[model samples]
Target: MKTAASSVISDNDNTPAQSIPRSPRLLETLLANLDGVVYRCRDDAQWTVEFVSEGCLQLTGYLPEELLLNQRISFLELIHPDDRQMVRAHVDDCVRLRRRFDVEYRIVHVEGAIRWVWGRGVGIYNADGEVEALEGFMQDVTERKEAAQALQEAERRYRSIFENAIEGVFQTTPDGTYIAVNPALARIYGYRSPEDLIVSLRDIRHQLYVEPERRSEFMRLMEEHGSVSNFESRVYRRDGDIIWISENARAVYGDAGTLVFYEGTVEAITERKLYEAEMRHQATHDALTGLPNRNMLHDHLQRAIQSARQKGGLTAVAFVDLDQFKYINDSLGHQVGDELLKTVAQRLMSCVRDSDMVARQGGDEFVLVLQNQTEGDVGIAEVMQRILAAVSRPWQAGDREFHITSSIGVSRYPTDGKDVETLLKNADSAMYKAKEQGRNNFQFFAPWMDTQVSNRLEMLISLRRALDQQEFKLFYQPKLSLKDGRIIGAEALIRWESPEQGMVAPDRFIPFAEEAGLIVPIGEWVLRTACRQNKAWQDAGLPPIPVAVNLSPRQMNQALPEFVANVLADSGLSASWLELEITENVVMKDAEKTVATLNTLKRLGLQISVDDFGTGYSSLSYLRRFPVDALKIDKSFVRDIARDADSAAIVKAVISLAHILNLRVIAEGVEDEEQHAFLRENGCDEVQGYYFGKPMTVDDFTDRLRKEAVQAAP
Candidate 1:
């Protein structure tokens, strides 16, 4: 049954071209009934239609019965105007070559829309082999042609991306030979052309390598991880100068999981590497001195410790501090101070070994790493003492000869500390001990230094919490008239009564507070509290005098005008009743800025007094520029006024200088009648000391005032 059915289908397929029993009329009827137009016409100006099918009416929206055998229109007239030349060329060319005639063109419908029709067949040949008639099939193949065109456009887009992508896309063989590369890849690898690179860079591990191991490393990472990120290395350029490159790559695998080649993008990273190095250096070193700053010091110390441990050698960690650097910094200008620091750094460098490290711990502090000290602590100590001597040598900054001294603290490996932080800290503590023993000296690590560290730590903790807990109090010392011996005003001093330790004195804690940055807030509290207390006194009918308050250098030099204004507002006191007592150190350190700041304060009606006048570097020329109302001759000059001739001379000169500047001179620390006699003889204006009565509480002060009032009436 299957064989009989298949034979019937085969006969049915060939039945269309088989001989027909129909006559010519039946053939004409067959042509009119066909689903497409079948035509033959002369190729001329009017190639009129010879036959038309019923389908022609449906195709061109025209009645085919009206236009048969050139009754109304020619087939050439239906051809689109724009495609006429192309169709004519194909037909004429085929005739000229005696080739088969096949062509496609657009034809306009009666309604004026264009449709594409494809024709195929061959040119009829004459007896002499000259073309006579053309026979072909016309079909609507517009859908198939559009689909082929879309495929071509899509291929062109992908080809464009593959050619011009910025990333160097490449493919290579398993043995690392280049197979193909884009134009971008060739430029990235510093080659003239992709073809040239492929030919010249046969062995990527050899000819293209700046570092031979780069290829090996690349292969190793690819094998292990199947991909690599930021795979960076140097490769030789065509001119042999090395350039940096980083690859983000993956391994392409073939069937059976065998590695085929590496495929990735190459990016030139030479400028990026150089920029990174520059940024790293900037982060780790001081810009002014070009020295390794505190950021780099810890790592260097750690590395030094590691090296010392390997050789079983001692690591000598020395903390270097320039003694009296502040004195010089305040005495000379900052320019000279900076030059001195540079000189000191040079001296420190000269005294140490080439392998050793020196780092600036900020300010005048330096940390030295002396690695591989063979003779133990003694050898390190000797080197440190030599460093002290070397740094202490007199050096000139411009025309002025200056002398400097350094304190060295030594901490050794496996003894004082086993790590960076501990070693650095111990060295710092030991350096302070050297400073205490008098600077320009060296000291080794001792157990007693821990006591100092613990005290400092405890003090810092107490200072932070002291304000919150209200453990800080102000003590008011009266400044009496040297002529009448009467209390005119008082100076407010801070005393800390800690729950842990009782009464931390100003002398003991003020320096620590300044160092630890607690003074800024603490100083503010003192100023406000002093002002408030003076206001209370005035409200309670006690005579109001300018309440003098000690100002630390940190507080005086930084934003003093703003702080003073804020304090006065908070305390409900006028500036005329408040005085800011600034030490000469504050005045001398940047005289121009100090003068400007003081003038601002003075404009607000606050009085300025120079405290400890003779102890600091002050110039008589610049002294006149300060907005000072009074000068407090330092206690040093007053202590030996009756005996020491130099002390007497300085005191007399200060008193005379103060009077000449119209600033009243106040002598501090007048402990006896003899000291008073001497100061009175020198024409001093104010005296404040134990002889006048020590710092007293408010109630005691009021009682003293009442008694003095009664005594005066009598």
Candidate 2:
């Protein structure tokens, strides 16, 4: 085939005399082996083919002689129908100009195949410069054209993915310069466009990453492992805002094993990071004040001890307790109590260095860790002084200004037994000592401090026995109707009658019982006893009046309403004859749960009263939701109502508020006629205080009821 093409080339150089048909073997051999057709045809409408090479059989599935001079088919018919007019116009323009023409168009083969072909040719002219014939070479370039089109379509698809993907995609050099970035990348970084991002962000180390070391870490990972996944970092956006981002990236290498760039995808994980942080904070810190809680405090204390041991320096664990916090909490409300805690937390933080740790060890108790104290007790004393000053500062809740102080107990490391538990115990013991020695002062642990703990243990044992021995007795205080001056109801107060001791007041044992978790059982006993006694009185032909029993905070659980219903049923007493008194603090603790419980109790037809109404931080919004029937003004207000204008105002306001809510108002501790007249004038429905009668034993109360019944008999 090479020799034939060489001979054809030699023949084309021959003059006319030498070209006189020397068998035409070389030209015929070359044409027969060629892959494309060589043709000449008239430049007319039919595109008459005058001659065609042997390669026409392969190119168009037709023998060379079959298409010669319009013998069988016109060459124009082989061109695609849609492209025929275009082909004709192109050739005509080229012919008129007498220049070579090149075009690509589809053609049909005899076997019903459509193939793309490239045609390059020039015009042969006759006299008067008119076009006579056209000469051209056509090649079947279908495979090449299809390959080129496939490449273009693949590029278009990749471009679409780069432009429209939700995750940001980027390509950058090893030295922290961006090479290419997609639209998603620009949007993720708060940029207007990809071009704008590329132009503005030049240094990824300083300009993009909030911490420049993150970029170095990224490059180090790529260099060592060739890829990185889930590499999270805090970065600065185009708007100069910080956000969290996670990257999945790999090194893109050149053919010579050199790193061309780093290609990666980025996800903005700011919200995810924030949510995780909140979860972690909630786990380790107090939700109310955002201070480290007991769980975190233990860990921090251990770490501080370890640091102190290694440095051979002293560390102080100071247990801080707010003085009279419980009184303030019970008298004012838990809302005020929480505010006091938060205020104390801020002051405690202000007293310590940045290296110190302040942690909340449950309610009203905080623990501080003062580490690296080489100056011994003097340094701790200075901090303690500062703490005392800060905590003693005046603060306000509502319209009233309050002065608060803290009692701190300090235990030095190595001196406090060198462990987290021991240090905390000693500190706590010393805190109690400080409280005993007149609060608002600091105390160091003494070896004899174990007495306080032993006393607590003894009280727990006695309390548990007191419950088993039925040493608890109920005393009833009569509630008098202010309008008619007659006893209408009575409050059942629990009294502990110990065998080894005289009568124990509620305040002496109730707090210990509550802390020891014996309150729930004790409360149940009180309820049962009160119900049975009231029923006995009614059975004995005495005038029946509603009997009120206080519900402790711990006893106000999901089981209380059902328990009360069962007690009423057991005693055979009408629900209308029973009243359950719940404290304001108890009701406000979990408002939704309290509402549900109160509604259930209400369904049982028992009278409910908010005991100590003005004392607690009860919101009127939640107050309206409670299913209580009355509000009991606390004895504290009535004890000095006539002497104190504030007390008088509070009593009147409560009476008005209760009436507005359609609830009955009862005043307690009305000791004189002046207080009674003040309450009666303000429309107080009932008064329960020494003015009417003191709390009496069951026998005394039964006798008194009988006397009243006899006197009422007309």
Q: For candidate 1, what is the total of clashing residue pairs? A: 0
Query: What TM-score would each prediction reach against the true structure?
Result: 0.57, 0.54
- Per-residue lDDT for 361-421 in model 2, tens only? 8779999999988788988898898998899999998999988888989998898768998
Q: Evaluate all candidate structures by whole-model CA lDDT and list the values in order.
A: 0.79, 0.87
Q: Give the alpha carbon lDDT tens digit for every residue of 647-668 in model 1.
A: 6866787787689899999999
Q: Residue 393 in model 2: shift from native, Å?
A: 5.3
Which residue pairs in candidate 1 have backbone atoms (N, alpha carbon, C) closer than 3 angstroms, thus clashing?
Answer: none
- The lDDT of model 2 is 0.87
List the candidate 2 regions with Cα displacement exceeding 4 Å. 1-33, 38-41, 48-74, 108-114, 122-132, 163-179, 182-219, 227-249, 259-284, 323-333, 372-395, 400-408, 432-442, 451-714
Q: Which candidate is the best by TM-score?
A: 1
lDDT of 1: 0.79
